[model samples]
Target: MIIVVDALNRHLFSDILAEMHALRARVFADRLGWEVTVKNGMEIDEFDALNPAHVICLDDDGDVVGCMRLLQTTGPHMLADVFYDILDGEPPLRSSRIWEATRFCVDTEKLKGRTTRNSISYVTSEVMIGAFEYARDAGVLDAVAVIDPVMNRVMQRSRNAPYDYLGTPKQMGKVKAMAALMDCSEERIAGIRDFAGINHDVFGSDDEVLSLFKENNGSAGNGSREITLESAYDFAPEPEAVRKPTRKDLREYCEAQVASAANDEEKVAALALKLELAEILRGDVQNRCDA
Candidate 1:
């Protein structure tokens, strides 16, 4: 599933962003041996501070398996700064519609056995499709990406081949890198969908997105795993479903929560207790009244 993080809503996706930066560090610095900066095992850069929109691909358990950074070419993008040498010294292409796509990485080894068309993994193609769709929807004309031969082949096989190339492929670590251009058009999106055999929307539903955040706050180091009743949002006294809280029960529950919490978390716990007790009352109103 694809989760978009832009300037306005970036704060709502802190956990995902942190995981994404970690994934980038692993894919770029450690795996690909790119000479990029890493702090606390996160590959965050200046452009990230620019608040560029990120198309983050999540696995079944909500872990970031793939991602690509999108930044306006008019700004401090790699093509205009870091990869300017690859432009062959003509001039860096700068335009509002032409965005620079960078930090395109995926968890290949982590998702090795994932099913996809053409015997390739799904995360890679899904990430590419999501990026183009995101750009196309946002009125982007085209995107210029720095990719290696391996990724180029993957794009070609997935039927989302780049329309043209820039200056040339330069030696970047053990791989050869080049700037490839692809349009953000209907035909390109359709071809990618066909190759991936995906006929429905590429993004996760609202419930899925909500579950992702809840899962993160409810668990540690287990993003992709599903939340069980025993672990997440469940402080029940028994296996049965919780009912609405009676007024007195809710008052006592709130009091207990406030008493147990010594810090600002008491306010949070009080609110949570009210909500939970409200559920208990909602479910057991008739039973409580009869008793």
Candidate 2:
């Protein structure tokens, strides 16, 4: 399940946010050996103070297994400040329609298992879909991410490849960083959904996410172990049926996406999706009118 944490609802997710920071510490500092600030088992930096929206993926036990940060490009951001070298002396692209996505990571140890719902690939696709959808609904057109070569390929394999890139790859610590641009559109989301076999909504409701966090907040973390996430989630014999959204829900969501579209391409994609939903919902409208 994906829960987006931002300034508006930060208070309700303090514990989950803390665990997310700790997970970052483990991935960026310990595993990758990045020169980041880690204190008391949590990795934090000045960028975290900017009130960016955090797209977090939780395991069945409610542990944060994957996460990424999103910040508007018109304000202070990593590519503009910390990673200025990647710009190749060019000024950072600043616009209200563009957002900077950073700090993407997943818990390899916790999610270590066969390729299933909780595998690294699945979680990565979930987080990517969640972040793009959330931003698209809020009027964002594009996302610029500072990613390494491995992540670039990961995005391609996951069917969420970047449409363009800004500046050349520059060596940063143990990896080379390049700024990749991805559009926020229905097509992008659909491709990822197809690749990951995720057809239902990826965002978890606030109540469900909070309840899960509350349940597992007190559980002590045991050292790494070889375990399959399918067993952890108690995989059912058959996949559960996805609950389809109501017609009203579909209309409102499509309207919001259409309203938020930033360019001609995005607007076209949103309208196409709206048309597709309209066809799917035509019978419901007729049935209601007859009744």
- Top candidate on TM-score is 2
Give a tens-digit lDDT track for model 2, residues 1-291: 999999999877767777788899899999999998776677777667767899999978788999999998755678877787998876677667889999999999888884778798899999999999999999898999999999999999888999999989999987899999999999999999999999998889998898877777643332232332213223222222222345554666677668777799998998998899888678778999999
Question: 192-287, model 1: which lDDT tens digit per residue?
Answer: 888777787878754686587557546444355343311321221231222333365446546655654558976786778678877876779778
Listed in order, each prediction's TM-score against the native is 0.72, 0.75
Pairs with steric clashes in candidate 2: none
TM-score of 2: 0.75
Error of 1 at 102 (Å): 0.6
lDDT of 1: 0.74
lDDT of each: 0.74, 0.82
**How far is 100's C-alpha from truth in model 2 (Å)?**
0.2
What residue runs in model 2 are displaced by over 4 Å at the alpha carbon?
A: 219-291
Instruction: Estimate the Cα RMSD of every predicted model relative to the unseen true structure.
Output: 20.7, 16.4
